[model samples]
Target: MAPTFYHRWPEPVTEKSGSMVQSQCWGWKCLSFGLILVVLGLLVPLIIFAVRANSKACKEGLLAEQECRTVTRLLELQLAQTRQDLVGAMGEAATCNQTVVNLSTSLEMEKARGLEHLTRREELQREVEKLKEKLQKASEEAERLRKEKEAWSKQGETSFGSSSKLLSPLMVPVCLFLGLTALLA
Candidate 1:
């Protein structure tokens, strides 16, 4: 009989060639089983190798991840420290600025006081100069009056005694008033 396909599987041969068909079928079954075994043997090792490589890669990835996490934590700590330092520096700067402002204000007040003192000193100097001028005038007037009184006394001494006594008393009062005025000056 001619070979024919039956559901993509070889139909069992009839009894016209019973032993030959049986032997060929047995041979085919042995070959197919051996091929399957060979393929399985090669694939099992390949799968095992793949599994081992995958496991190793996963372990390395986990280790790298752990290292990354540690680095991230360290970086975060450094960032926090840097932020604290910045805040402290800023506070110091603010304090310095306030100090500068206070010093500037103090300097301005001192300048104003210095100006007022200078004006007061100048006014006092002017008053002192005026007093000195007044004292000089008074001294010159006193010298002139003394010379006039000496001349009058000499002239009156040769005249009548009564006129001399009257002139002496009047001159004494004028001289005493001038002396007191000079002392005050």
Candidate 2:
């Protein structure tokens, strides 16, 4: 009697509304399904061809990706430097922590022995505080360098997963590692 929100579909033009509705729904579904299949069928072969062609192109020219190889070498050098820095920071932190412990121990001893010079106790305390600060700074540097090393490692992994691995053998350790694992397995 009155228009409602549910009246969006076209009302049947004839008494055979059921048949017309069925045809309309089935026609759309079939057309859409066919289009999807056609698109996938065309796309799959095209993608495969592109991949093979790219690989073939890489195999053809060795120097074509010289820039990529140079970049990879630079990244590797940076990673090595980062690793060295992390190690140095860790060593410095360990040394500072040891010095703090030594200073703290001597300070306790000086207090216990009733050292006549209060200046000695105060000096030890100041040295201990300075060492603690140095230890904290060294620890933070180590952590930061560790994170940077990890980021560089991840970036190296992703960047080499493509044709670069095929073109440059030395920089792509992930592929070699995988191959070795596969053999071992």
Candidate 3:
């Protein structure tokens, strides 16, 4: 009869007759150990390659970071310089604006003064015209009196007998002329 499932078992190694070397029989245990060794051998070289690549990448990253820091520091200094320049420019602009305001105010004041001066000049001109008119009138009146006096003197020489009446009217005209001249002057 064929053997049943529970009755089956692996046979053990027995000594070989007429052989000098003993036969080895480790079975599944040897196969599993060899497989584990092959896998570990492949993983060791991959781990070394990964470590070298990682270290190289880390060095490159450090250099890049240092370069970036240098650039950032230079940019920061430039920014500070630009800010100072801007502040100086703004101060100059403010000064210029104030100067412009002052100039405008001075110009306006000068204009007002000029207008006032012009008004004074006009008034002076009118006064000069009035004085000239008064002077001309006075000169004409003096010439008329001189002509009248010449005529009266000639008549008095001819009519010396009635000199009292002619002299009285002549004195009145002369006095009035002198008074007008004094007032005009």
Clashes of each: 0, 0, 0
Instruction: State every prediction's TM-score relative to the real structure.
Output: 0.53, 0.28, 0.55
- Between prediction 1 and prediction 3, which has the larger lDDT? 1
| lDDT by residue for model 1 (55-172), tens | 9787899899999999999999999999999999999999999999999999999999999999989987876677667656666666676676677677776554556556656765
Task: State candidate 2's TM-score.
Answer: 0.28
Could you say which candidate leads in TM-score? 3
Better of 2 and 3 by TM-score: 3
Model 3 spans > 4 angstroms off: 1-61, 157-185
> In terms of lDDT, which candidate is strongest?
1
68-175 in candidate 2: lDDT tens per residue? 889999999999999999999999999999999999999999886776567767876776676666656655655675576566667877664454434445424644
Model 1 off-target regions past 4 Å? Answer: 1-65, 157-185
Question: Could you give the C-alpha RMSD of every candidate to the true structure, in order shown?
Answer: 10.1, 48.7, 10.7
Q: Worst ten-residue run, lDDT, model 3?
A: 17-26
The global C-alpha lDDT for each of the candidates, from Candidate 1 onward, is 0.81, 0.74, 0.77
